[model samples]
Target chain A: MTVAATSIGTPGDLVSATASDSALRRFLHGLPGVDQVGAEARVGNLATRSIKAEAKRWALDLAVRTIDLTTLEGADTPGKVRSLCAKAIQPDPDDRTCQSVAAVCVYPDLVAVASQALAGSGVAVASVATAFPSGRARLDVKLTDVAGAVEAGADEIDMVVDRGAFLAGRYGEVLDEIRQVKGACGPAHLKVILETGELATLDNVRRASWLAMAGGADFIKTSTGKVTPAATLPVALVMLEAVRDFADLTGTEVGVKVAGGIRSAKDALRYLVVVHETAGAEWLRPERFRFGASSLLNDVLMQRAKQRTGRYHSPDRVTID
Target chain B: MVRRPAARPVRGGERLEVRKTYKLYVGGAFPRSESGRSYEVLDGRGRLLANAARASRKDARDAVVAARKAGPAWSGATAYNRGQVLYRVAEVLEGRADQFAAEVATAEGLTAARARRAVEATVDRWVWYAGWADKFAQVGGSANPVAGPYFNFSVPEPTGVVAVLAPQGSSLLGLCSVLAPVMVGGNSCVVVASEARPLPAVTLAEVLATSDVPGGTVNVLTGRTAELAPVLADHLDVNGLDLTGVAGDAALAADLEARAAENTKRLHRAPGAEPDWTAAPDGPHRILTWCETKTVWHPVGT
Candidate 1:
């Protein structure tokens, strides 16, 4: 329950001794490949679940609380980060029925500002580190990035996996890098972003998901929101399946976070359905599930307004951050 | 001749008439009023006609949002394509003429002949506006003679989302006259139908949905103008107002225009009295009312 200061496990010993290169390869490759058409069909089917009335109201509120409200712009200033923190604290200032989001995700440099702004608020400050969006920087630079954010009082650190190492069949190197970032994150919980768009296949997504969870990722994220096809239903489904399988094998639960392109209350509910049916109801908690999105919060608020007032809401009535 | 027993009702072959449950048209979907309240629409002789959705102010705000969302794509569409789409609305309306005429006759207490004339005039007005969709820019825009060696031209662009209060008395003809011109220049609109006679508006919305018009392009809400107009007027996102329907209530009209000034929305105040919609002009002025003139300058080569 207390993810902020608790370390999940030690890095090298996290996986079994059988995680040697060939052994890891055999384990990863032997993991079942996904049926693309079947996966897509399942996602489409789950999307049609008509969540209405009380269920819709509950989903909307939970979605607001599950959001990792993000602002990762090159132009993000302290003022913007502070306002985002305020938004995370009280999403709908006009209506008190709305709730605060889970976290405020910003670049590493603005972690302190967000942490201070959201000091008393239950919302956490999550930082995107490890040369985020690319993960192309050297291992030492990535570690410093992690350490700096942890020093700035970040409760959570979202680090990207090195796609170059993974695509080149350097699976051990990828696992090792995640371990290094996890080690650098002293008390901060770690979320390993797969950036599944660049990973090329469902098999790659599955392997990366297992690799991150095996490397002691408190949560495995879908994307950096900088890539096309980020955080899709099938990819999230694969990650969810991986976490479920990993828990079955090791008895440790690693959470799942789906980021990017998820803009509507309907879309959030669909992902929640995937989480519910695939990973069970336990993963429905904020500590276990998160949506790394900015616009998604507003949509959830709008839907909540509709539910409360029994009328469709306007975007103008909500703040335009 | 067939005889039916009073107790047994032996005439079992009689067909039951299925009446429609008129609802508010938002985002191209016919959803009942969110408030779940309905009011009886009656014929002029006070006979029960059907129950119409009593749309709330929330519905008005929703209509504005839908119109705003539909504004860009509808405006970016080619003028020729827009004209064709508008023409298709007229085509669909023509096919449903009998239904519209019946509703008009019942709502207005008009003779069948007069109701048919109203439908004809409404269809003709659409065709008129359809033709102007592509031609209005040419007549309204111009190549300005600049002071320096520059080629400057002014072109009309849609003024975003406009909110219209459809005439209460002339529900069918007046609705078409006010609605068509707002859309001819590519602006999307949220229309509050005639309070007492909203059946025609709902029927027209059905026609629009079946035609080539995109979802959210023209949202129709059946509700009290006094209750809804204030919301639309104060809605910061709405870009323009057509107050022709509020001509009879001067105080209400003044209040709405003042509230509209909060966002400096473009106001088309109601005329002293509802202009004879049957004799409404087929000119470029109405189309240009909700348009912004954009001027571009390019340097001339030697």
Candidate 2:
């Protein structure tokens, strides 16, 4: 990890202890603003790339491997968690060609249950903490929440950023909150959620992206799935660009996780194309790029089955997680 | 150049024929097959006519979505309004009589006169169903004299979305026979057209688009029934299946019926041998096939 305690005048250091608050503000504001129309046009252009036949088959399989299958409902029960875990381990019972997903994400209370159900399976157990969808709780409470999930065997912690703080121009406070959550995560990787839906603007999204990376986030995520415009293509494009630029400056690779509203194999493939073109092939792997979704896996599996059998697969055959 | 002809001289009668490209009808728009695959449709004489969209299972799923999206408003439409819509479809089909007759003649190897007669009968079938749209409830629903001091009545309501397998042999008449009745009851449908003769089915979709019938109310897909039927059968969103086309194939019908049991969808299967679609009894059976009886009770004394 790159140290935040560095000289202020260093060219690429985003977080320097010697830099005054005004200098830090200038550094963030000095970052180029996004051209919304151009970015969306570029995303739309990339979405038209036709990955057919063998390439499509490969992309479908890789998309299945990149999913962090999530269930964040308040009515979540042990039975539901167990079933989701079972689905994560063996997505398609009839087709062994389907791979286990990257992880199973759930509420922190069910972390132990998911961990136990997914044991011996390579699928990691991810839990949403830090008061989850809304990071409105006290910093101590948020840290405790992260600690509890980590103590319960959560292999990855998906923590939401304090949007109110970030929006109120308390950038230092937001950065410190992420740092504390990272410290609380011990061995588990920390995924800092920017919740771009509430971030208000693409410039804010970019600034938050840099802030999260500087605060030592292992992965910068797009949303919590509770907001209206969660994980849109333009927002995802900006986040991907942020990670690419961060890697150039700090030389530390931070991952990206796009959550919410992605529901089809076609949509997943489009996101894969964006990653392939913008972030290059290195982020194409699950370790660097992930899709935080619940319904996207089944669509991918269905497409994979279609590719294999030369016909469409029935939705009833797959478990309805 | 001695005498300038009254009209420009025609070079060797080499006029270019603009062959129509058939596409799948979904959610009111005409789109090519999502799978980007098409099958060659040949005339009975083994001559190529046009390439018909070969819809895949994804297309079947999309049709289900469209049917579901169109179901609520369609089922809630006034019976008289629905009758008007059906009559409008008949009107539109009547205007395109020669095109349909030519297609039917080419597809089925029928004489021109016989094909024109079939087209006329198909148009009449729509009119027949148009009248039934407002009458099925009165003819089918009833009030029973209950033992208790409660007034009970059985009313028929549309059963949401339906999937229809149009008859394979009588492509035009059989298609109109199945489609008109199912839609007359206010139930939206996704029809898998006759595999060997799909031209008239898509042509019928063009007619429906111009009629007063709402978009997504009737989605027609042309492709292999064997490949597309199972997906529709297993679709949980579909409320009913009309297996009129698979009447003779007992094994295929049984297989589809078993899959439909996943959602407990209502099934309407035709008996073996093609039915006389021009007969008078076609109206009640097809409409009632997809209607559910809801019984509501009211106390006698206010």
DockQ of 1: 0.14
Which runs in model 2 stand beyond 4 Å of their true positions? A1-12, A15-18, B1-23, B32-61, B64-124, B127-172, B181-188, B192-214, B222-276, B282-302
Question: TM-score for all predictions?
Answer: 0.68, 0.74
Docking class of 2: incorrect
Per-residue accuracy of model 2 over B1-302 as CA lDDT, tens digit each: 01222555557975544457889999999999899999988888998778899999889989887888898788889999999999999999999999999999999989999999999999988898899888999887899899999999998889888999999988899999889888988999999999999999999999999997889999999999999998898777788999988888999999999988877888997568778866766338768878999999999996
Give candidate 1 regions above 4 Å deviation. Answer: A1-18, B1-65, B72-172, B184-187, B191-216, B219-276, B281-302
DockQ of each: 0.14, 0.17
Q: Which ten contiguous residues of candidate 2 chain B have the minimum total lDDT?
A: B1-10
Docking level for model 1: incorrect
lDDT of 1 by residue, B63-91 (tens): 88788888888998999999999999999
Per-residue lDDT tens digits of candidate 2, residues A53-119? 9999999989999999999999999999999999999998888868899999999999999999999
- Against the true structure, candidate 2 reaches a TM-score of 0.74
